[model samples]
Target: MASIKQREDGVWRARYRDEVGKEHARHFALRRDAQRWLDEVAAAVVTGQYVDPKAGRITWDEWTREWMERQSWAMGTHEAAAVAVQSVPWREGQISSVKSSHVQAWVAGESKRGLAASTIKTRLNYIQMSFRAAVADRVIATNPALGVKAPRSRRAEAAMRILTAEEVREALDAADEFRGFVEVCVFAGLRLGEAAGLQLRDVNFLGRSITVARQVQGSTIKAARIVAPKYESERTVYVPDELMTSLAAHVTRAQVTAPDEQLFVTPLGRLWNRNNAAGEWRRVRKDARLPDEVTLHTLRHTFASNLIAQGCDVVTVQRALGHSTPSITLNVYSHLWPSAEDKTRSATASFMGEIRDSADSVRTETEKPQVRGSRYR
Candidate 1:
């Protein structure tokens, strides 16, 4: 049975019971609309397909945070995910009221705010994932975010900046004062934090290698901390001869006060932070007259690029850089692989030469003078 009410303003409200015995209500300016809604609800209830309107009232923002809190993400990954989730426009709102248009608007607004294409796409992905979880929980009948296209992240191709050999040399020369950190990053491909957190025990001078086991982090000098290396994988990278010489010299000059002390420390004997290293790299790059875009990570890219250009295989480079997979190394440095056109041309030329030689042999046999004198006559 359905109940109807008419307010003094003449608007009508209708209430009905669904097949599942759940109550639903709707208001309309016209009695016909209210009656129509009741009919639709009754038919849906008969078909066992009625959905409560209250389910669609949750806001997108509320569900996203709930999803994030319940997820177990990596150390830095959780922070990144939180930022992306917060970047959504309706981040604080209920998930049920969010429509596809809101997502599109958020993406467009993020672009207008000068967010990088990659960042915008990442935020969109996080939102979509959140909505997916909502869909699974029956908070919404369907994910409104489905089929939404994210802007392609062009910054990846645009930001493929690599340092020139001259710039690398200039930066290395300028880093003579902080040779240990510079050599490890530029040659051994140690990330900034890994290099700063390295202890003397992590170095094997006899093996000509260093183990990346931990990372230095935190904001305050009093609260400086060491965290496990990214991905929890400790890798040993072989040192180049030149880098070995620089490391040995820097160690002797620094006269490290404690064997357990960090190999790269500030003048105050505290762990070196990324900001300080970046500032030093910038100063060196400027002193060497290199472009301002060159950064500490640029040294790592240079190392990988130089290695790939030297015919080092992708797997070897992957291990050298402490990458978890060779695919990562190949994806970044595959462009530097030798061109296949030259090999194809050489192969074609070799095949053509063989064909020509075979043709000459056939012609020589066909044109040979008759040797009938020794035949029985």
Candidate 2:
């Protein structure tokens, strides 16, 4: 049941008892507005479908913490997810009350703050997913993120910064100090965490492959405990003969100090930090006179792009990258397909030609043969 009352200040209020026996009230400036709200509330109550707005009243911070608590992944990734979630524009306000306009404004602000498009897109997606979950849980009537627009992402073709073969050699040559880790990243395409967590036992010299089954995290070397790979699936990546020789030479030079020593470690025998790797890459890039935008991960991209450009199939690349699906590989590297434009043009021209030929044959057959033969018979 709902009713409208005019206050002494001439403001109208719509007060109602929802189907759940919860009281809700809203202030309106006009009588018509109050009446409209009252009518809607009454209808919802009568239909036994009234949902309490308070149920949706959670802050972005609160909901993200809940999500972090419930996630069932490796601790390293869970911590990463939590960090990403916390980086959003969280404030002491109801998550459901966040409108599409608010999200659009936030995105604009983030762009002005110079955050990368990829990072902003990722955060926006996480918030959108959080709202979606809220909607599914009946905590909100509708997801405010349903039609919200994210910042325009850079096109893959435009954003790709794959290093050339000569540039790769130069960068690798400059990174001779961390050559083992760099070699693994370049040849095996292992992620930074995977490379940091590599142990001697994980390498099978006889099998000519390395197993990617763990990752490392945190600042302290003592905190660098092993966790499963990103997808929780153990897989092996083959190493090239030249890279194998490099690995063997690197191991002999480093000299194993512990029974279970990590394959790539700092001079102090600590796990490598991605930031440190990136810093080393910056120095190496300067030494090689490469462009400023190039980083260590460019090596991985270069490897994948080279394979794709050389006619390696999507399935092979997917396995090498430890991707769960061929579609994932294709979506990321489809821009590397150099002949896409030419192939599209050729296909379109062939299709049109076929249509033209069929039309001409139909016209000739229809116009020529029918009349005289029937009259003679």
Per-candidate Cα lDDT values, in order, are 0.76, 0.78
Number of clashes found in candidate 1: 9
**What are the TM-scores, per candidate, against the unseen true structure?**
0.75, 0.79
The candidate that achieves the highest TM-score relative to the unseen native structure: 2
- How far residue 219's Cα lies from its native spot in candidate 2, in Å, is 6.3
Q: Where in model 1 is the C-alpha error above 4 Å? A: 1-23, 28-62, 155-158, 217-224, 257-259, 345-377
What is candidate 2's lDDT per residue for 1-377, written digit by digit as tens? 67888999999988987656678899999999988987876675576544577876888788777866776767766656666666656456777787877777887888899988887877777778777777766677677767776678788889889887788788778887787887788788888888888888888777789898788765455566677777734688987788778887877898854636888877666678666667766888898899998877777888788778767889888988888999998889987876778779989999999999999999998889555556655
Please identify model 2 stretches exceeding 4 Å from their true place.
1-20, 23-35, 42-49, 76-80, 88-90, 218-224, 257-259, 338-377
lDDT value for model 1: 0.76
Give the TM-score comparing model 1 with the true structure, all chains together.
0.75
> How far does residue 14 in candidate 2 sit from its true spot (Å)?
6.5
Error of 1 at 194 (Å): 2.5
In candidate 2, which residue pairs clash?
none
